[model samples]
Target: MAMLTIKDLNVYYGVIQAIKGISFEVNEGEVIALIGANGAGKTTILHTITGLITPKAGSIDFEGNDLVKIPAHKIVSLGMAHVPEGRRIFAELTVLENLKMGAYTRSDKKEMENTLEMIYKRFPRLKERKNQIAGTLSGGEQQMLAMGRALMSHPRIILMDEPSMGLSPLFVSEIFDIIREISESGTTVLLVEQNAKKALSIADRAYVLETGNIVLSGDAKELMNDDSVKKAYLGE
Candidate 1:
């Protein structure tokens, strides 16, 4: 079964429409990338799915539940975790504290500790900086922390937006590698990214969005090879 599905979703911002009837699905254990240029409404789609923004019309179904009617905080408990666009970690909190916050919805203390250990094993840097203030970390480290924090929720599906937005090439590569590892480990991922080549490289499937609509979608390798996609997105 598809892990998450968005159907005929339309969203508006004030008088302007940001997303127009775009629909897609992320299947279990698949890495799905939504690639688009700035203002193409990729983040808008994610915000709607996470309940940060409500759609004017459509349905967001995840694991047989309608996300549109659920509260944002409740969405987390339903096993949909969102790693927002900006690496929005709690700036004042220590890395450990920030990670703990991610588990606020859970009452399973023992399981949360195990997840924390798993995260630390995945990114030892986070373990090294566990006591450091989140704001003091470098951009790359902050991004790592954000992903680590999201994983603390032990989510069934992870939604990431622009994870490589501001970082050195090395960090960007590292982040994508981690994403691949995360997917391989069986956590379904829905990625929104402007770094088309990198996103397409790791994606199982991809959808190209243009001006609030999906213009192309298929296997990642196929989209990577398309002439139009190459010129417009892959910088080929």
Candidate 2:
């Protein structure tokens, strides 16, 4: 069933429309990707869904709740986690401290510890440097910390923006592997990435955006094989 649904989404910055009547759905346990070049408004869709940006017109439904009416902080408590484009962990905070902040919606100490343990098992480097300052970590490690922090929310669905950006090839590969593992373990993902190839590889379905509109969408593998998708996004 659809865990998240966006219908006729129209968003704008002042008078400039950033997303124009786009619609999509993410089913439970599915990894859905939105791929486009920079300025394509892919991130805008995520921001709108996560309640960081209110739409000029649209309806965002998360498990029957109207996301547009909900506050951003309350959205996190509703089992939605966003790992933003910049890995926006608190720079001065310790790694553990940043992670603890993600669980602010929760009150159960024992459950929190269990979640922390799961996060550490998934990102062992984080466990190794739990007390280290977040800003001191390498780019890839910072990315890991950001993801770990999101997982600490125990979300049913995750919205990831530019997850593989600014990483070495090896680290990118590692990050993608973990993303697939996360999906396999049953957390639905809505990924926005300029790296179309990587995004489509792990996604069950994909939407192609261009200049504030969804130009195409379908099963991930079919889009990967499409001539236009190959030429425009796959660099073939």
Candidate 3:
């Protein structure tokens, strides 16, 4: 069964239709990339799936439950974690405190601590700066912290939006590597990225979105080698 599924989703911002009817699925342990240019409605798809925005029509099912009918906070408790765009960490909180906040839905202290240790193991920089204020960290460090915080929820599926935005090339590589690691460790990933090259490189499958619609989708490697994708997205 697919880990998450969306069927004929439609969303709007008042009178402006931000996402036309679109559908996709993320299977268990797969890294599915939704690659699109700015304003292509990739993020809107994610927001609707995570309940930040209600879809005008369609069904978003995660593990047999309709996400559209559920509340946002309840979605996370259902083992779905969203690492939103811009690394929305609490600026004033310490790194460790921010991580703790990610696990607020849980009450098992021992399990939360174990999850924290796992996060530290994955991003050692977060462990080093555990006591430092979140806003004071460098861009790469902050991104890692954001990812680490998301993993603290022990989610079965992780939704990441523009994780490589505003980072050096080295950090972009690092973040993508970590994304692969996250998937290999049994978490299904639904990634929305502007960097088509990097996104396609690691994705099991990819969808191309243009102006609020999915224009194409196929094996990531096949999309990478396509003439149109090379011309428009890869700068080939």
Candidate 4:
């Protein structure tokens, strides 16, 4: 079933329209990608879904609740986690502290510790540097920390924005592998990525956006082989 559904989303910034009546749904245990260029309003869509940016018009339903009506913090407790662009970890905090912040909505300390241990297992580097200051980590390490932190929330669905941005080729490959692992571990994913090739490679379904509109959408492999996608996004 649909874990998250966005219908007729319209978002505006001042007098400029950012997202224009776009809609998409992410079902349980599926990886859905929103691939587009920088100005295609991809990030805006993720922000809107997570309740960070309110749409001028639309309905965002996560499970059964209208996300548009829910407060951002409350939304997190509703089983949605967002790993925003730029690896926005608290610069001064330790890796453990940053991860702890992600579980702020939860009250079960023992459960939180169990989740933290699970995260440490997935990101061994994080476990090794659990006490290291977050700001001191390398770019790739910071990205890992961000993902680990988001997982700490025990989300039913995770929204990842540009998880591979600015990484070295090896790190990029590693990050994409981890994304697939996350999906396989049974967490639904809505990924906003400019790395169309990598995004489509792992997505079960994908939507192509341009200037705030969804221009094409279908099975990920089919879109990967589409001529237009090759020329415009795959750099074929």
Candidate 5:
């Protein structure tokens, strides 16, 4: 079954439409990349899916539930987590505190502890800086913390926006590797990126959006090899 399904979604900022009735589905355990340039409504789509922006039309269904009507915090409790474009870690808080905030909706202490340990194991850098303020960490470390905090919620699907933005090439590769690892560990991922080549390389499937509409979509390898995609996004 598809993990998340969006049907004829139209999102508007007042009278100005940002998403023009786009639609897609994300299957369980898949890494689905939404690649487009800035202002193509990529981030808008993520925001709409996570209930941060109310859609002007259409439906958002996750795990077979109608998510369009749910509140943002309620949506998170229903197993979807969103890591927005910016690494929005709490700068003033300790790393541990930020992680704890992610689990605010959960009550299972044992499971929370297990998840925390898993996050620490996955990003040992976070463990080393557990007591340090988030603002003190380097960019790459802060990105790791953002991801780790999202994982603390034990979400079934994660929506990531421009996770590679502003990182060095090495860190960019590392971030994608971690995304793959996270997907393999049972969380489906829907990724939005301006770094089209890198996003398509790791994605199981990809969708190309232009001016808020889907212009192309297919298996990642096929999209990567497409002449137009190569010219436009791959710098060929």
Candidate 6:
């Protein structure tokens, strides 16, 4: 069974439609990339799935439960974590404090501690700066903290929005490597990215969105080699 399924999904902000009736599915343990240009509604699709924006029509099923009716907080408790765009870390909080906040919905102290240890293992920089304030961290470190914070939730699936944005080439590669490591460790990933080639290269499957609609979708390898994708997104 799919870990997440969206059918006939639509979203709007007041009178303007942000997402058309789009559908997709994320299977357990797969890295699925949603690739698109700016304002293509990729982020909007993520927001709707996570309940950050209510859908005007359609259904979102996560592990067989209806997500449209659930509140955002409740959705998080259901094992869906979203690392939004712009790395929305709490600027004034310490790295450790920020990680703790990710587990606010959980009460199992032992498990939380284990997860924290795991995050530290995955991001040694975060461990080194656990006591440092978040706002002072460099861009690369801030991205790591944001990702680490999401992992603290022990989510079954993570929704990441433009995680490689605004990073140096070295940092972009590092972030994608981390994403691969996370997927190998058994978490499903739904990634939205503007860097289409990089994202498709690492994904198991990919969807192409344009102007608020999905234009194409298939195995990532195939999409990466397609002429149109190469010309339009890969700068080939």
Q: What tens-digit string does per-residue lDDT give for candidate 1 at 47-165? A: 99999999999999998999999978799989989999999999999999999999988899999999999999999999999999999999999999999999999998999999999
Residue-by-residue lDDT tens digits, candidate 6, 67-178? 9999888988999899999999999999999999999999999999999999999999999999999999999999999999999999989999999999999999999999
The Cα error of candidate 3 at residue 71, in Å, is 0.7
lDDT of each: 0.94, 0.94, 0.93, 0.94, 0.93, 0.94
lDDT score of residue 52 within candidate 4: 91
lDDT of 2 by residue, 1-236 (tens): 58998999999999999999998999999999999999999988989888899999889999999999998878999999999999999999999999999998899999999999999999999999999999999999999999999999999999999999999999999999999999998899999999999999999999999999999999999999999999999999
lDDT score, candidate 2, position 22:
90
lDDT of 1 at 17: 91
Output the lDDT of residue 180, model 5: 91
Candidate 3 per-residue C-alpha lDDT over 1-236 given as tens digits, one digit per residue, 9 for 90 to 100: 88798999999999999988999889998999999899999889988999999999999999999999999889988999999999999999999999998898988999999999999998999999999999999999999988998898899999999999999999999999999999999999999999999999999999999988999999999999999999999999
Q: What TM-score, over all chains together, does every model reach?
A: 0.99, 0.99, 0.98, 0.99, 0.98, 0.98
Minimal lDDT window, size 10, model 6: 71-80
Model 3 regions more than 4 Å off: none
Pull out the clashing pairs in model 4: none
Q: In model 3, which range of ten residues has the least summed lDDT? A: 1-10
Residue-pair clash count for candidate 5: 0
Candidate 5 segments whose C-alpha is farther than 4 A from its true place = none
Clashes of each: 0, 0, 0, 0, 0, 0
For residue 212, give model 4's deviation from the true position in Å. Answer: 0.4
Cα deviation in Å at residue 79, candidate 6? 0.9
